[model samples]
Target: MLSLFPQILFLAPLALTLLRVVLAIYLAYIAWYLLSRHAEIEHAELPIIGHARHGILWLSAISISAIAALLFIGAWTQVVAIFATVISLKQLVFYKRLKEILPFPPSTCILLLCISLTLIVSGAGGFAFDLPL
Candidate 1:
């Protein structure tokens, strides 16, 4: 499989971009759905934001969306990727309903973080708006 790395390097930028966009959209969608539809459901089990006000969820969603946008366009690729990876892990740790994300191993956040780390190491690839470092 290592031999295939160079073969698909050309597709890396696009793949990374799509990954960021999807993660962002999913985060925003989950936050929106939970906040708007289940505001009173009381997810008191969240490790990070359980004690915080509900507004924090909105802020997290908005921030994640913005970071996703940045990651999509390859702007500040390394920095944004790092930020995104950290946030993604945090979300995975705190967000309930793990089974809803994926029925199998390698949850969405894990896959996304791997992709983000690849972008960080390899840069944005040839098709990116911001060239790899």
Candidate 2:
């Protein structure tokens, strides 16, 4: 697989960007549906702010994803993709749900933190491999 690393390296950031988008979309829908529509009836667990927050989140995500793509293409210098990943992870952490301090349940905070931390670790690995000496 080391032999294919070049090709994979060329492709993986795009894949990561795609992963971020799909994951964000799914999470957004879950947050939105839970807080906006279902809460009145079934006691939705995610925060109401999370739904509205997603629009901004996804926008920032898109711009970051674009930068990641550019970094992948080698159009610019340094590990911009790593920077983008970190920024995205930080955004997730920023919006993490906390029922007492925030209006959202603790579960959402846990879930988002886990996801963001996983992404951060994954991004760190990618950066170590991707960066130039």
Candidate 1, number of clashes: 0
- TM-score for each prediction? 0.63, 0.33
Top-scoring candidate (lDDT): 1
Model 2: per-residue Cα lDDT over 1-133, one tens digit each: 5674575577665554444444454444443433443334233234444333445545544664555455434333234434544544544564544222232354554554454444445542233334342
Q: Which residue window of length 10 is worst by lDDT in model 2?
A: 124-133
- Per residue, candidate 1 scores C-alpha lDDT tens digits across 2-117 of 76468776675566566656655654554565556334434444444454456775675577667766665657777778886786576566456443432223476677667767
Error of 1 at 91 (Å): 3.8
Which portions of model 1 show Cα errors greater than 4 Å? 1-42, 92-106
CA-only RMSD, every prediction: 4.5, 9.2
